[model samples]
Structure formats: C-alpha cells, structure tokens
Target: MIVAVTYRYTEDVALRDEVRPAHRDFLRGLADAGSLLLSGPFGPAAPAGALLLFRADDQAQVQAWVDADPFGTRGVVASATVTEWDPVLGTLLPAL
Candidate 1:
C-alpha cells in the first residue's frame, strides 16, 4: 500500500538547523533505495513541515522507516502522522 508520512517540526531553531543535512541525506538514501516515492516540505516560501510518500506492506514498516529519520531521532518532529493514500491521480506514474 501507499502511505503518506507527514511530520511537523518542533520549535527548535538550532536543532532544526543542525539536522538539515542529515535529514537530506536520509531522504536521498531512501530515494536511492526506491522506497521514497516523493518528498518535500511545506510552508509559505520555505519549509516548516514535510510530507513523504512511501510504498510499504503495513503501518509498522512505515513507522520503522519514519523512526529511522535523523530528524525524528533529534526530536525535530513534534508530531507525525501516517495515512493510506490511493493514487487516483498523479503525473509521476501511469494513469490509474
């Protein structure tokens, strides 16, 4: 199934800044491993939060993946949510 992992960052400017590189590396690794379908941040002009899409068997697998994030380990994520998404429309893949 497809899962959407959404996370909100804690209000820690220093920690957030410190983890930015590691976070990017982690996402890049996931992309290389073919687990990360899409990822990006959310905010007005910059990024305040993030959304990651992954293909996994169940919620546990998704949780494990999210838990491995450097940002998650550093408490950069104030909260995280996982939801099942049906890709009824998208440009990255063939029409469903």
Candidate 2:
C-alpha cells in the first residue's frame, strides 16, 4: 500500500540549516531501497512542512521509516502523520 507521511519542523530555519544534508541523505537511501516515491519541502516561502510518499505494507513499517529519519532523530520534525493513500489519478498511476 502507499502511505503519505507528512511532518512539520519544530524550528524551521535551524532545522533546515542543521539537518538538510542528513535529511537528503536519508531520503536518498529510502529511494535507493525503493520505498520512497516522492518527497519535498513546502517551499521557501511556506512553512516547514514536508510531504513524503512511501510504498509500504503497513503503518508499522511507515512508523519505522519515520523513526529512522535524521530529522526525526534530531527533533527537526515536531510531528508526523501517516495515512493510507489511494491514488485515483496522477503520474503515480500505471499506464492503462
């Protein structure tokens, strides 16, 4: 199943400055493992929330993934919400 993992940074500027590299590396590892589908920040002018799409079997797996994030470990992410996602139409869909 696909899951949407959303999180907001506690200290936007500090978190970005301090953990950006580690965060990128962590996402890269997830991509390499075929778990991360898409991920990015809310943009420079926006709040420090991020959205991550993941293909995983269950919420436990999603939680585990989030728990291992450098951002999470460093307290950059204040909280996260993991929700089951059903892609009705988008680039995420397979060619019919």
Candidate 3:
C-alpha cells in the first residue's frame, strides 16, 4: 500500500536548513530501495510542512521508516503523521 507521510517543521529555520541535507539523503535511500515514491516541501505560500509518498507494507512499516528520519532524531520535526493512501487515477508516476 501507499503511505502518505506529512511533516510539520520546527519554527527554527536554521535548524531546518541544517538538517535538510541529511533528511534528503535519508529519503534518497528510501527511494533507491523503492519505498519513497514522491516528496517535497509544501511551498512558501503554504504552511511549513512536507509531503512524502511511500510504498510500504502498512502504516506500522511506514511509521517505522519515518521515525528513522534524521530530522526526527534531531527533533527538527515539530510533528509528523502517516496515513495509508489509495490512489485511483493520477499520481507521481514516471512518465512513459
């Protein structure tokens, strides 16, 4: 199943920037392993959050993976949530 991982970043912009590279690397590893499908920041016009898509066995697995984030370990994430997502039509799939 697909899991949607949402992250609410801390208000400390410097801390967020400092941990971004490590966080990106962690996500990259998941993508390389076929777990991460899509991910990005919410944009300046929106709230300070990130959305990540993951292909995983279940919510528990998704939670476990997300809990391993460097940012989370370092307390850069103010809050996080994992939800099971079932896509019907459009998605972030690679172009044919």
How many collisions per candidate?
Answer: 0, 0, 0
The sequence of per-residue lDDT tens digits that candidate 3 reaches over residues 4-92 is 98999889899889999999999999999998988999999888999999988889998988889998998888999999887776644
TM-score order, best first, reads: 3, 2, 1
lDDT of 1 by residue, 1-96 (tens): 888999988889899999999999998998898778889888767557889998788888889989999999989999999998888766865621
Q: How accurate is candidate 1 locally (lDDT)?
A: 0.87
Q: Across residues 1-96, which tens digit of lDDT does each residue of candidate 2 receive?
A: 989999988876776678889989989999899889889888879877899999898978999989999999988888899999888897748821
The candidate 2 region of ten consecutive residues with least summed lDDT is 87-96
Better of 1 and 2 by lDDT: 2
TM-score winner among the candidates?
3
- Collision pairs in model 1: none
What lDDT does each candidate get? 0.87, 0.87, 0.88
Question: How many clashing pairs in candidate 3?
Answer: 0
